[model samples]
Target: MALNTIIINTTTTTTTNNNNNKEDKELNSITHFFCAMKQQSPRRRRAALTTFFNTMPYTIDESQVLVMSSLWSMAMTNPTNPELPFSGALHCMSLLINKSLSQPSWLLLHQNIYIPYYAAHIIGSYTIKSSSLAELAVDAGAVPLLLELLRGRLSWVEQRVAARALGHLASYDSTFHAVALHGEEVINLAMKISTSCLKTVYTEFILSEDRKKYHCDLLTRGLGGKEMEDRKAEEWASQLQCWSLYLLSCFAFKDKGCHYLICRELGFLRELCRMWGGMVNGESPAGVGLMRILCRSSVGREAMAGCPEVVLSLCNLSRSSDDWQYMGIDCLVLLLKDLKTRIKVMNMALDCLVDLVELKNLGTRYNVGSTITKALLMDYHDHDKINSVVYRLWELKVERKRREGMMVEEELVKRWSLGEAKKKEGNERFYSGEIEEALLLYTQALELCPLKRRKERMIMYSNRAQCCLLLQDADKAVSDATRALCLSSPANSHCKSLWRRSQAYDMKGMAKESLMDCIMFVNLLVGENREKKKRKVIKVPYYAARMINKQMNAVGLFAGVVTGEGINMQTIEEEEEEGRRRRRWIKEG
Candidate 1:
């Protein structure tokens, strides 16, 4: 019996909670509907509120009043949260805001003017980075609402909010689809607002200056406003124009959006260019930004080609020494990359490129930029005309680079040839026994030798070493021979340089160093003989024994008596001549 009673009590508690939840939901709905009604005029408000209250089962007592207060607080404090019970109210406010902005009837304006401004700003701020929230705002009729605000007489702040909301909504695919559904009206209204703001800014500028007495009255009369405080207003107007342009850019950012924009009017590029002329670089980015997007597309490129104004504007922009300068060049480069585009467009792109190149050269000749060569080389189509155009531009780039490279190479060759001629002249002077003149010429050749000619440079050093030895400068001979050996290849075996160094070492009384070189020289000579004829057995032993005797005499009992002198070159030459005769005799036998 106690178990049954406990189960019954549990069931009773659950039912009670469910009843309270249902009651709370009805009350929340009533409060939400009432808040939405309050945004209407007094007559509509009274009628809607009374009707809702009369049909309601519960009245607003103290606890219910607290519930209503909390709901309003949440609506105002956290309007961005989609979970709030006031979501219906937010939607209603959004629609009403559009209505008031579009109609401007006194009754509609009287209902709530500032509510839409605040609502639009809050919605725009919340949705700027959140596509989900932007879609939600769009579902609540934010696009048309923002469009209405943009079309009507909105304060700069309201216009800014509305323009930003439109931009945010346009960032989503679904919302942009909805936007494109009304593309003509949206584009036309945005252009109108931008043009008006631009005109107002100009007017404010004209009215800003006071007439100077020195100036002619007829010239300055219509241009001067004595008591106009339009500076602050002008700034706001400019800001609004910038945001309006941003909204337009958002529309042009996508492929479908761009198609929709230019499909209606081929002259749209001209209008955009006209607006671009009035835009300051740092103060506004959207005008030029939209132009960049337009130039990115094939249709837009074609349109831009037909419009000379756009070409001139881009040319001017490319010359500006500002942040947008690269962007201007980038757009032109993009158009130039696709040669498969229309001929007119391609010609226009070429003209723009030539203008940029000229301006770039005028600014700085050496540091120029290039487009991605691979993009131009990509096989987008098989048309010979298109391919030839790309091929021609590529050839121009190649030719330019080749000409520059050839110029550099020619200079290098001239220097190298001079070096070689000096070396030949040095050889002639050396053979003529002009030792000093030969030394100077060899030094000049060494200086002129390029780093790439390693072998030639080594040979030059070896030749200089010979000159140094002939001059009895043993130190200079060792230095030059050592450098030649360092640059020598092992396969070729720098035997001449090694022998010269060995002789220089002996002149300096370095017996151990001289012996090492003599051993290497004998080994190389014997190896060469074994690879060729086999008749070098006798002369090899003789040369080895002579070097060993010199080493022993220099290092042992006769160390003080011996001078470790250089090789007897004349005797060695006689012995080599005799060995050659013997080898010939052996071969004849």
Candidate 2:
């Protein structure tokens, strides 16, 4: 009977919590609807609040309040947490706080808002980290207010946050310049942090950290095996560390204005980035945003030099496990594109893309996954990228085709080539045609082909497929041909392979596909032939390339591209929607 009541009570608690969640959600929806109705207006917002208050009396769940409270408190401390903490009457108040800034709403005249009245800030120990609060704070000129609170050395965490909020205030050039000019004060604040116990309350492992350069890996040491509780804390530590580094980096750049400051910060940033190489805190986006800012800053010389280390570390994060690699890959790609970090970026990205089908995130993986997906598509537009993805796809296609026909082609050719004397010894062994060995040899030969008269990947797959067909692997033959079709038009591939795929399909009872490929490949090839025949070959004499123009004699050879550093480099500025990429490459002769 006791167990039954206990079970019943547990059930009731769950139901109540679910209802509260529903209430929170419904309240959120209604709030947003009214907000949209008001377009963030005062009266509609007030009406919305009136509705929330009207509904508030119907709700009461003290049992799991702390659970919800913990989440709310988390949202307060971490800016990246989703907007649940600001739900209902409280969030509405926060919104009202900011909305009143642009327009002196009557709420300000009244002074006491619902949020502070409820004492949510004191109740939950919430800070202004909640974005709503941050936005409102920024909107309300909280820069000076926050700076003042950061003055004395408080709990190490509080001092760090103060430093960060001050850092954020300088997000824009005007404010950044303002903050930068406040050098003595900022330096004084940093000096306090630099001197304090490096180790503070971060998830557990951070507690054990040296608070120095070689701090323990948050994921490895801190969490140990208790991932659930420790993961969030570890992530927050990474973000805070990154934010701290960013602010300091910028601070050093702005205030001390010396090489030593820049070098130390740059060195620290490289280490911090290394520490953060693979950790994911989907809840915190400042890391990605901070890195982007540094990349875009005038400190490119040092930042770019340190970029590869960042990529290498981030890639290590990726290769650690499949759980975070997807998001890591996305961030990795963006990190890769940052000026000089492409090589590591491309290789890892291509490797991951080839193996994974792209997955979604539940708790904190959404943005990073989307970021990676967009980059993959972006790479799809590049020739080398297309070549890579397509080639891998064709590889699978070839295997499928080979399985369909166990006979011989690319593999068979290799088998035959293996022994010139064997060919003379027995026509029976050759043609009794141990179809399996022949097929293997033919496919192997295709792989070893030095120069393709057509599309390389397709030709290889096609030869392998025919070997399969000879071995009566009909499905294998069709699969290879289909992949070849996708890899190249007839113009780009050898003719025999295309026709062979068509014939292989016909034998496999796929006559329609066979006929379609036959016609399509021929038409494409014909088109290419016509274009080539019409185009003139640029046969400029080698001497003409080296010849000096009389009009440019005073300007010397005038063959090199112009550069700011007096470099005669072949640097091209390719302006992309995201940013500019100026690559200096060897000029084609």
- The candidate that wins on TM-score is 1
lDDT of 2 by residue, 422-510 (tens): 32223333366665665555455444432222255455555566667777776566555544543454221445555666556556543
TM-score of each model, paired residue for residue: 0.44, 0.32
Range of the 10 consecutive residues with the lowest summed lDDT in candidate 2: 580-589
Q: Where does candidate 2 stray beyond 4 Å? A: 1-141, 148-152, 160-198, 202-239, 242-264, 277-282, 285-289, 306-308, 314-589
Residue 131, model 2: Cα distance from true site in angstroms? 9.2
Give candidate 2's TM-score. 0.32
> lDDT values of the candidates?
0.57, 0.42
Off by over 4 Å in 1: 1-113, 153-157, 200-229, 255-267, 277-284, 337-368, 372-397, 403-589
Tens digits of per-residue lDDT for model 1 on 346-441?
454443343223121222322233443443445535555554546555554465446545656667677678888889999999999998899899
The weakest ten consecutive residues by lDDT in model 1 span 564-573
Instruction: Give the number of the best model, judged by lDDT.
Output: 1
